[model samples]
Target: MVDTVSEGGAPRRGRFIVLEGLDASGKSTQVDRLAAWLETRGSHVHVTAEPTSGPIGSLIRQSFAGRVPLDDRVIAALFVADRIDHLTNARDGVLGFLERGIDVVSDRYVLSSLAYQSGDVGMEWVLHANEVATRLLRPDLTIYLDLPPAAALRRLETRRGIPDRFEELERLTRAYADYELAIEMLHEKDSIVRIAATGTPDEVAERVRAAVAGEL
Candidate 1:
């Protein structure tokens, strides 16, 4: 469902794009670049991340850190709850910007839910939960930055801050393998364009932009 809005008394609608991958897959960098490129191209754009840093997002983050221990199913539900809130806010935020003809892009979306939760449950269940939670707000395009587990670990090591519990996960080989499986599952029904995330930021962003545009 699309929420149309008017910015400064001008009417417009926004396009929703999602970028997904495991940690260090260069999602953040590419999301930012896409938003900037969209703006430069005269499109109004808003960039956001999940867990959204909102109240729901905060709880999910805490749960992730083991600060608040919840069952895996509950944790998955919390993540979806955060998306409902984030999407609402994102809708409102984008509508205002879209009224000015802006596009909205997200660093991580339902795909992340599928990848992470698929590890816990079946891909079908993860997809079902996300579908129910998002009210089926599918992204127009999903750019999956595919990186090998070792390369991802390299990027993780160079990351500036202490790793979060998920980042500290040493079973990344399993997680990565799980991600690949999730990708296959999603490709069954959506436009999931895979890009090599093994290059420089600009290079990866270039590949992503090309893939997004090509898919769109």
Candidate 2:
């Protein structure tokens, strides 16, 4: 395991990296690529995603499928609950891995909640709900894959054959606007970097690597 010791007696925590973007922004693909790259460089990496594979996540998935009819505020609340569980679960959780000196890379994080949920619920309420989660598990780095809403919709249509609740053109346009506001509202602007996602997977990966070159 990699050594992480702070000036104090306690061990320094491992890095927490997050990938955020609208639907079909290639965040999932790049999360895997970044994890593989970190492993090759001898880092013990733990990869996870928000809307985690837990009870809350299950409800979120059902909501997406129109099976679970939750209001926007309830959906956002479930996201926060799942995120807390993902962080605090003793086994197979993000914090557990990080405490053991393993770097964590998440496919999506609080920024995504801010972007998507804020569109449905008002920004003030969404931000308040996420405040505790963000304080507890803020990413060390957040790479935003920037793509046009129309382009993202085309990609989803071509790849998935069916669109999910959040993949529509109008919602995506609004989500992008919320993302901009979220980025600006973040306490540390330097923690986030945007990369154009208008190229092949390999090309986008290259830009992601370049953006976090120093950390790597």
- TM-score for each model: 0.84, 0.92
TM-score of 1: 0.84
- lDDT tens digits, residue span 75-168, model 2: 8889989988989888788888888778899999888988999878878888788777777777888999999999998888887444568978
Full-model lDDT for every candidate: 0.75, 0.86
Question: Where is model 1 poorest over a 10-residue stretch in terms of lDDT?
Answer: 1-10
The positional error of residue 55 in candidate 2, measured at the CA in angstroms, is: 1.0
Residue lDDT tens for model 1, 1-216: 223445555455667788888889888989999888776666667888888878888988888766888888887888878877776565454334434555778888887877777666667877777775456466778888888777888889897855665664555666777778877776766678888998799899889778866775
